[model samples]
Target chain A: MSGVKQRVPQIILTVVALLLIASAFVARPEGGSAPLGPRLLAIADQEFATWFSILAVFAFLMGGLNLVATHLAKIRERGPDRFYSLVTLVSFLVVLVIGTAKLGGPPGLQGDVTAPGSWLTAVFDAVLSPLHATLYSLLAFYIASASYRAFRARSLESSLLLGSALVVLLGRIPAGRHLTAWIPEPLAFLRVEELSLWILRVPNTAGQRALMIGIALGVIALAVRMIAGVEKDPRSGGDGS
Target chain B: MSGWFAPGTWNIALVGAFVCAVIVFSVIRSRRGAMVAVRPLPPLLALDRAVADAVAGGRPVYFVAGSQDLDNMQTVAALAVLRPLARKVAEAGGRLFVPTNRSLVMDNAREICRRAYLDAGRADLWRDDWVAYISDDHLGFVARVDGLIARERPGLCVLMGFFASESLLLAEGGHHVGAVQIAGTASAVQLPFLVASCDHVLLGEELFAAGASLEGDAARLGSLRGQDLCKLAAAACLVAGSLVATLADVTGAQPWLFLRDAFLNVFRAG
Candidate 1:
């Protein structure tokens, strides 16, 4: 893999990737509102996309191999953290064997490894599903704790936070209308539900959108850096020696 | 028949104007020897060094690729940091432990680590166990990762990615362990917790750019530049739109709806 032959393949692959990427953006799609160039680009884009997707699959395979090799070596070295390696290998092999042997399931279109009564389904439902539920469930406790801590009335911002939270929390609850029912028709704007709606639509949504915009900008900057290859991965920046 | 700018042209023009203004300002500043200097990579390197040292001293470096699939930009950012982090650990002979809630992420992390190690010529040191997949259950994953941290007692822990309430529990646990922690997330909800507990917190865009900042890749830089350009354009449009709407409201003219529709159409096209 370190020889000149490897370099040749790498170079070829790089060239192919560059050309495809270029084509995807440069050529135009046909018979649309877009220009001829753009139409050509669209056709080229589909072809490039398909090829790129296949390449990604290969990348995934390469990654899987690396994963297996890394763990296998750990087991062989009997490293102090070897138990971790053991667990990893066990999990990988169990899934791999189950998938290949189609264990606990009947075959389907592509050999339904995921068919009912299959170990895959069992693992997914019993192991994976429960795990997801449990992790998601933690949000309840975390949200409560965070709310208590964040809702403290320390400053103007804190007051706003507490106020908004109260409005929303109360509005959603059955107790809100009962509490606000005494308000006159003209003052009905003070209803908890209406207040909550206003807060969400005006303040909460506005803040969320602003944050989203900032995030979008940041992502663009980062993408430019990567595309320019100026932001080399530190690992690759090391001396080849 | 409409030119590129058309009614939507104002936004692009505004961005162009801003850039021109900045360049002119920068030139003037440079001539006066008052040019602002920027060093973007040092903080990331320092953080990496801190993470590496912690991992090197027989303590694992805890890393989570957020609660997202690798496709998410935040997840990619986490992996970018992980690449250097894993190498530093490999070089220092320390372990890098990444417990992923997403199976695909485990795959991505493994690839990134392997590439890092191979780049370092210490591919032999990279282990699959280094990036393990726990339960996909968010809380289950959190519990398992937390347990791993408790048992491993890593010197440094980094929680970066799209997070929610689970982020708090993880950060709090890291705090309890007395590990030096660095956290980054786009989720504003989790930012306070990370800031409260982690030694360093990458907020919002900082999290998005952390990966690109770690590397001085021109492509990534260009993307950042493009994004900034887009943002400038957006801001200009925002101001213009607001003014137009206000003016239209004050007078009998109704240009505001046209501008709004134009903006909406442009955004929809994008």
Candidate 2:
């Protein structure tokens, strides 16, 4: 009985999905004059997608509670770390209360607490966005360090990589173009700017396309497996045996 | 409902049908007990060792399932790997800590871990704390993992799936704590961060392969056979198309140019 229960949903859902996909090819009936199958599939697709969006909203609220539970645990631990936890929770509550209660603005227009001039918006604009920007700025230093480690010249490949890196780096900035301005027009292709742009348009694009293709194939394989019921029976958590 | 069929997606539908045909063929052959060969991924090899090491030393294994909610495909596919890993850890009497930022993901992880432990006949080892929610904020999750890494000093760190800017920071933190790190992702932009910082890195498609192979089901693994065959066909097309275009460029031949366009038309969107 349990096995049947698991397999039934999987089979039905797969059929419904395949139907929806097939519906994309069937031309819509004009003025509801024909083709019941295509119309039903279209309805199923829209309804299912709307249902998914509703579920996502609920999940977002659940995620908020999850964050609260985690930080509350840290506060209960009673240590120096508790200070950070308290800060996070207090900040969360202040925003929640102010936003929910609509303390600043007129009532019933309470949603999107990050609206203009609200306290939540003020905190976001003055404090949180700046902090996010600060964190993003740290990535520049991290990128430099990572580039240093990656571009070190220790082997034949590394030497070529380092050379390529130097060219690309010099080509991107105006100072680099100025440094190579003395190169004759006859050998203009050797200029850092042209070389860098060529590298970006040619080799870099080629590599990116290859990666994108591979990812596409991987996704196709996964999607096919899902449609074929090959991965697992989601309910039983096994092959529908 | 915007009527029945949507235009401008026929190319995708055609490609999907081709892939589905290939998959159906492969699945049938696989079910008949034909061999579906898969190359061993080096990073996944390291994964086994790291898990074993964690078991031996009685240290915990930490898995970062990225910052995405449960809706993300990477997170969902990653559970294929997490389930088996949970089973292994349970059998070995060691612990696995999975920090999820989404409540739904946490719930899914708990169910997967529970089922895995039950399959391994170690259901007693399963605990809700094994997989729990942290915070949804990207940096918030990274900070929590950093503290966990610094304190627990896990024997193994598996960071995989969809990762964004926090990829390098969290991987570097794991490295700072001196754990054997194995990172995998299909995020093209974040691949280098994992490669530069981790002990072993699974680039792009290799992550999917790792998850499938760990599942140990031939029918599931057979999907890779179809993917490989499609890739081979794609490679042939690329080589042929490029040669035709080159010929057109060199000889300035109208016929060659016409052939090149014909080849390109197969892939071009309408």
Candidate 3:
């Protein structure tokens, strides 16, 4: 009975999927009211997708609870990371309360959570915005470090990759174009700008297309497996019979 | 307004039906003791070894799903990979920690882990908190994953799904922690970054197949083979279309032009 019950959700999900797949063929009007089947399909797809968002929004409450629980447990245990957990819990509560109560509303406009000159915007502008920027800026340093490691010419392939990367990088900038201005039109394709475009449109695009096609097929296969009841777990297909 | 079929998507529907039919037929054949050949994926093979080693050493394995909501296919693909991975961990008597950026992904990961543990007959080893939602902010999620890598020092990091600019950041963070990193994504721009930084990468469709291929189900494997046939047909179409287009351009030939248009119309026509 328990096993049968466990399969119930999966079964329903599969049935819904099959219906959607079938309904996708139904023709819908472009500028006017669609036929019943097509209209129903469109509505179903929209409703299902929206339900995912709604569920996720409700799941946010669970996340908050989990965060609080995890941090509180850490504090209770007095682990070495207890200080961090304490800080996290305290900050989380502060933000939750402030955001929930609309405490940042203007003095005369207490109802508007996002009122102009509100503390929420102030905190966002003065604190979180800068923090977001700081984290984004860290990417520059990381890219440089990663590039340095990747560009090391330790092998034939590595050397080719490094050389190609240098050409592409140089070709993209104005300085590289200026340096190649003296080159003749007959050899214009060898110029940095032309070479960069060729690499991007030709080899790069070719490789990307191969990957894209493979991924498309794989996703299709996954869907097929799901519909066939081979993939039982609607989330991950973890259970194999 | 009276029609039931979508005029614009008729071709797509037909293709989908054909593919689904092929998959179903393949599944039936597979169940009848027919052998289905699947090519070996080096990264997935390495994944098996890494999980076993990490478990034997009593080190935790971290699963980082893509930083996207349920709207993204990459997140779903990542969930697929988690199923087998969680089971592997449960069977090995090790812990699997999953930190997701989206609430839905967190729930999905938690359910996946629970199912894996239950399937392995070690449901007691699974913890409700094993999967946690870190943040919805993309960069914020990456920052949290970086912190987790630094603190937990997981023996292995499987970064799979749809990733963007933060792909290298996460891979590099795992690299800095000396963890064996296996990453996969369908993002063309991020593929090179992951390939360069991670120990192994499931390029493109490989990520999607990674999860499907985990259990070696005949239906899944057969569908994979069917997809290969579709790919070949697509490749042939591309080559033929390009040839006809080039001939028309070079010769000003009306026949080649008509052929090219006809071929394109099949795919693009409503």
TM-score of chain B of 3: 0.90
- For the predicted complex of model 1, DockQ is 0.28
Worst 10 residues of 3 chain A by lDDT: A232-241
Which portions of model 2 show Cα errors greater than 4 Å? A23-39, A70-86, A109-112, A233-241, B1-8, B249-258
Q: How close is candidate 2 to the true structure, as a TM-score?
A: 0.89
Q: Of the candidates shown, which would achieve the greatest TM-score relative to the real structure?
A: 3
* Model 1 Cα lDDT, one tens digit per residue, B16-93: 345434434433443455523334644365676776678557677888889876557788677777776777777776
Clashing pairs in 2: none
| Candidate 2 C-alpha lDDT tens digits along A1-241 | 8867767877976897687667668676666765677767767778888987898778778768876876787688785678877887898888889778766555575465556767767777887788778776767877776677777898897687788889998998889999889999999999999999898899889988888777788877876777667777422344334
Candidate 3: clashing pairs of residues: A26-B4, A26-B5, A26-B6, A27-B4, A27-B5, A27-B6, A215-B205
Q: Per-residue lDDT tens digits of candidate 3, residues A1-241? A: 7667657867886888877776667654455565566767778877877887788779887777777887788799998879878877886887777767677584443477677776677767887789789888877887887788788999998898898898899888889899888889999998888988988899888988787777777778777776666755644334343
DockQ of each: 0.28, 0.44, 0.59
Task: State in Å the error of residue B196, model 3.
Answer: 1.8
Off by over 4 Å in 1: A1-40, A52-56, A59-88, A152-159, A238-241, B1-59, B67-71, B79-144, B163-180, B187-200, B211-233, B254-270
Winner by DockQ between candidate 2 and candidate 1: 2
Off by over 4 Å in 3: A19-34, A106-112, A234-241, B56-58, B118-125, B250-255
